[model samples]
Target: MSKRSDQITLVAGGAGFIGSHLCRALLDRGETVLCLDNLQTARPSNLRLLERDERFEFIEADIVNPLPLDVLERTWSIGRVYNLACAASPPQYQANPEHTMLTNVVGTDHLLRLAERADARFLLTSTSEVYGDPEAHPQHEDYRGWVNCTGPRACYDEGKRAAEAMAFDFARMERTDVRVARIFNTYGPQMHPDDGRVVSNLICQALSGNDITIYGDGTQTRSFCYVSDMVEGLIALMESEQVQAEPINLGNPNEISVNELLTHILALTGSDADVVHRSLPVDDPRRRRPDISRAQRLLGWQPRVSLEEGLAATCAWFAGEIDGGRVPRPTAPDRVRASVA
Candidate 1:
């Protein structure tokens, strides 16, 4: 392996929504990035922009299994590892519950071992789902979640919980340098229109002139962090001089109800789509907002994008995809892969 310090970064699931953006950010900083993904839930179009970059290399592989160590050793000396691998959306994740669990537990273990061997700085991009149907409002990192291990969402919720456990264990027992970011609801360009996430669903339904489906009474709330802001926070947390063994929340604190978010989407698209209410999925969190005090105190980072601006930019990207006929209409069963690690 080339022993060039701080030159190579390994981003597992680097072709997915937020991962793709992180890949771009790393390349922008003049680092050689080895992006690993199975293209399971990640769209190939997301990597189109980085394909031509001489410093970017995409490896088609799954992290649930051991990585190709010989190839990794010959390719570059990895200095940083970002474990962003896992299917994030509820529908996408629940579709393959067992695989999702393996991706989080087994996949995380594989990467943690690699980080240990390489002596690289490791950052695990955990999700807000770890705080399942959170009992606490504006969840702080210290709050143990109110999760249903037997419920439909348990696969993802518990999977992430287990991943965090493994990451911290590695840090304490194996002396691995580790960071964890409990990412909340994030939306932006490059999001899969068919992923069934609320932000993408609202934008795509409105743009397609379909009835906007609100899963509950539309009273459920979520705080959304823009993709760029999220990527920035991840980088900041990973590069911080201070050790962060405990997970830190990385998300926008601006909370808005589902109805209000739909209203904004409707107004932005100028679509006269009818509103439709549906049954809420079991175990869905009624409200989710991050208490980012720890992130601010630790990394000196806070989200700068407003919901309005981020939504506008996201809408424009979907509009282009629709007009260009490049958006793939992924079927429900077909969407069943562990998207990112």
Candidate 2:
């Protein structure tokens, strides 16, 4: 977990929604960063935030192929490898299921090997989706998920499960330092406009004055963590000497129904868009929430942002995307609601 000042921390998928924020946070902490991304589902605009930093370097490559280890070793010592690669959204991952699966399987293996060879700490950004329609509420780390291995969304869900397996096996063999953070629903600025996540979808649709799409009567529940909080929890996991190979849940414990989330978004965006119901996507989790007592006990980390405050910022971000900065940035105080539209 210790690194010299000259050592580099590589973030695969660094230009993505959450990845970009992680990269920026490292840079803000004066750490040198090597951001590797394939640009498949990531956008160039996200990189604009890091391009000017002299300590930052972006390598455009997919992890499914051989990593540019020759370039990496010749230039700098890799102190850390945070594997946030692969498309996260259902629409994006489902669009190229093979690539998604390979990104998690082969891609994670590639990064783990790189970390092992570099003698660096490796962290895998696993997902909460592993608990498919979980039988248990407030899922914990010991729960061996209820995933459908053959479902349409299995490309990401099961693939991440396999990645965690390989990571733990590597740790079990003493290959390298490993940490896994099973992240729940996270949203905020820098999220791709078309990522098709529930938060982004509703906010963008509302800002565009379109009908709000709700799936499954909007009764399914989820716990949303602010992107900033997620980035902090991730950094804590990656840097902690206390965490070894155990998977820690990183998310807000507060849970709400999908309709509840929509209500918050509608209030923030001030959009009167009619709600439309659609069939739920295959294998969509009926309930999702993480019991983060492990995180609290192990890493001393928990989400610090409230739902309304986080959604306000996200609405502002999507508002700019929908209409070219017409909507002003969110400035509501705690416990107050204001419309971004």
Candidate 3:
């Protein structure tokens, strides 16, 4: 292990799906981790698994406000910071657009300053949504996205775009070492039961004999990367010395249409659910896929988990959640709390 591996790391959204997994991976590498989350879209149950680990610490706070740097400094010495704090799903993010915008901008700025104070490497988990309704297929790093700044999804899409701009500005002017990952759609275990993402929605609805709703004619396509694979790509990008101050696409290249994904989930769950169509939301991307050539060349990373294999694992986890009555219904927002293990 390198000497830097012993340094403390901070994860802004450590209690969320991807953030929790990254925290565990960092802990496994013998690094002390400080996880900060407000639990707005995430639940405390996600951090339950790491509660017993002495090296892991959880702080309940929102990133939209300035981070508790004083408390953090008293706790441990910061070395690397991973800013994954934001409402990812459309339904959740759209619920409070103002908060979402502030989190991506103000929250990101705070973390960048913290990174500068510690002289640590900073990584921003930007999203493919930055490339709104991409005019170019298989989006590469160089393609400037065609995004609507005033659309319903702009709070997140444009917010992330601004976050990327802020990160690069800090990198160029302040010379703060930074990494930006333009992550594509991802799914796996620990996803919120009511995350409102297509994968979770279809799987949960199929498992419970509900109609599989397909928005936008079920023809729109997305490339889904497994959570574990996505985490590996993030870590690789952060650790690589060759990649710096640039955005890299990290996702599986295999594109699947909404209808095709629904069929696969139905087969996997053995459900005879009916398929229902609905109007597509405003500014929804027609085709979503990532061009991971940069990730492959720079970080030696590409998704290794096949969709079929990854979906099966995800469905199994959702099944356990449903059978145990842990799945939250759409109408009730209070039931989204995490179940402590």
Candidate 4:
């Protein structure tokens, strides 16, 4: 429920990596926020700061079931929604591919329907994976993508693609106001220690001086966006009146190969670890980068944080957590154990 004048905004996965940041951003804007999450993959502590705000409320609910009609009735004044509930990373999504697909397809379907019922503007947090491996070097918005429908990763890639399609249908047919962002690789503090994302994995391994693993000759490249920059981009899109604009790429264009990233991580953490090669996962993209011309022209948005600065902040966070007995110790070089002990 809003406090009379405060506009309400709903964040479906408000406890997860990107969602928590968005929730805080809304709170900063003095908007009342209702966060609905099952906490299946999200840590409650991520949003611990919001517990005291009267304007912020957390609901332990899944989006797969019927929308929380009761909450909606009480807070029916919600003006916007940021649908970010789906499992994001490979480890989490691939663990239960069927549910992951449903979370995207069915979950988006349900949210769009709710947006229709509430007359609220909707924003879907889609992924750059929707573009698949990409024959284009820097993927633009119009690329149809090179996704294999039968591959394991398709559950997430195609699921999001389908989710975007559904959102488009709602906006075109129902004339609902909608915005979508094809988010690329984003990393920052609060990422799960075992999330298995490239940035997190590299940082965690480097912190403990573990053998940094690189797949497929460490040649696959990725563009990394800091979480704060990504949140800013999402906010810009939300504030825009771009009806049915559902596929804009939101990512940093500075590309780095896996090996180069690991080297930087080692330098950042001062970790003496050997880089090791492993087979690339099935359907892993050989390269990816976002062409942000649309974002620049439309929203005047671009990522400002340098990789070194972002990684340093993230490394400091992980190091503090490790020293304070918050995050678990990793199987790394013998050096870090001595530091922690």
Candidate 5:
């Protein structure tokens, strides 16, 4: 598996949640991987294992600017490109809205041009957030979305939608082989501990035995897709010759409310965590899920891992990382003692 067949894959943001997993898969399938990452939100721990592999090389580069022409000019064959490089988490993306938009818009433009020049098959990891707060229960790929361009979450929502548009344009005008996968909520190991995502925040809070913060009335629903299932869908979409030059939805069909997810995590962790309600952030989606009928029909894909199983695995990974000193253990909140004068 370590020895690859000169099929160089430039994985933008390979040292990332889904991207890292994809890189591992490529390595297993005996394809050489060149991970192009700036390590902004990515953890080096994710790529630590792959560092020793001769076929795997990590290039600390940003796609907002042009790719290193020197590296591209050097004698190394690149046949595939997976553009997984974008600020996904709301807090991270919102921290710098302009950068997030540019990363999606300019970054895609740059990578698509690279794909065209290299004659490589391009795969874009788009987001289901493109649907915004869905009017429907489960969103289909064709849903145009009801988005607020001036909202706080617009950076991610509109950015991804724009990325999809760019991909289609490149596919048509430039005649580049392009593939798009509309990813839904995915969680697994190596996610930023404080990624400000609901799943991670809830899990960590429960593990620390703190109150679980639920935004809104906790009735808003979301579908959780295990990272492995999603990566498989991406691979299928890329490798399939029958489907091309279009967008495909990749996610789980089972939807659960925020309250339900918190209860489940608390039960799994055996933590005495209480539920706390908070004001919902502006433009926060009330409901989000993917229909995935197209994925099943065309790509023959559906999420295989159950939520329970995936969560257990994720919890165990976090536990091990914390215990082994790889990841910091979460600390309980401070308590105040009553003082009498």
Candidate 6:
């Protein structure tokens, strides 16, 4: 994934959880990085480590609008463009559905055109939500999906679908070299504690001794991929010579249920929290697991971290995040202590 020392890689949404990690990975490879974000759903602390590197530059701008004048005026040559700019979490994206749709459709167009202008390779971080409430278990890239275009999650799901179309259109028209990654549930350190995702919700609740919330009778299943593993897959797909204008599935295929996930977190956190059940959110996918065969065949990639190991690491990280602001819980487990150390 290394480019020339002087080549710049631009990551939209670089101040967010996943994007920040990608930015650091690029910088570590000796590439100059421009991290662009509007700070809407981004965490300010995500950029702290990146600011110390002179090779990293942060741009404050939203992709839904036209590219900033200063950005267009800049003379630096961009070799790669990664669009991870949209709000990913349901609560965040659903809060402003209109903006979410625009961020995916319009924002994606802005970045693709930029890639077209610079003759840079482009990558879009599309989501598994595109396969809304999918009937297909172990979903593959070719699945047309069963998404509800008018459902609550439609803003993100359909928007991403449209973004993929536009990205491939540019490629088909011979305007941009495009890579589309249909990412599945990803979790790890630096995830916003209140992002409303199952991993964050269950882990934070267990760590804080709050009631564990299980939705949809606790039978709905989802595969969780660790952030590092997902980042590796993303870079591999981006650098692979064989993939272009083709969507590659990127996620861990180890499926676990909502109740099962809470059980693991409770064990790791030593939480005695009671379980609570709630109705599933509208259009929530009952089963989600990527088939990832394309990723393995095309890029020689598969998840390296086991679910138990990744959960232990996430619990340990959240212990520091939640308890650091409150009194230390005496029930904290030793597994979390050892995992972080």
Alpha carbon lDDT of each predicted model: 0.87, 0.86, 0.86, 0.83, 0.82, 0.85
The list of candidate 4 runs beyond 4 A from truth reads 1-5, 242-246, 331-341
Tens digits of lDDT, candidate 6, 254-335: 9998888878888899999898787787888899999999999999999999989999998888887665763233332211
- Please give the TM-score that candidate 2 achieves against the real structure: 0.93
lDDT of 3 by residue, 23-101 (tens): 9888887889899888876756779988789999998888887677644564336778899999898878887888899
Q: Which ten residues in a row have the lowest lDDT in candidate 2?
A: 332-341
lDDT of 4 by residue, 1-341 (tens): 11234567889999988999889888888788899887877866787877778888998888877777656685458788899998787767877788888889888888887778777888999999988889987999999899999998999999999999999988789656788999999998888777667887788877876788776898899999999999999989888754245578899999999888888888888999888877788999999999999998888999999999998889999898778877776643222211100
Q: After superposition, how far is residue 267 of candidate 1 from its true place, in Å?
A: 0.6
Off by over 4 Å in 6: 326-341
Question: Per-prediction TM-score, please?
Answer: 0.94, 0.93, 0.94, 0.93, 0.93, 0.93
How well does candidate 5 score on lDDT at residue 293?
92
Please write out the lDDT profile of model 5 over residues 74-177, one tens digit for every residue: 32366788999986887677777887888899989888888887778889999888888888767987788888988889988888889889999988886578
How accurate locally is residue 121 in candidate 1, as Cα lDDT from 0 to 100?
82
Candidate 4 lDDT for residue 174? 64
Query: What CA RMSD would you report for each candidate?
Result: 2.7, 6.1, 3.1, 4.6, 5.7, 5.5
Arranged by lDDT, best first? 1, 3, 2, 6, 4, 5
Off by over 4 Å in 2: 69-71, 74-76, 325-341
lDDT of 2 by residue, 61-171 (tens): 899998986435633388989999988888778777888899999999999988988889999999998887799989999898898898899999999999999999999
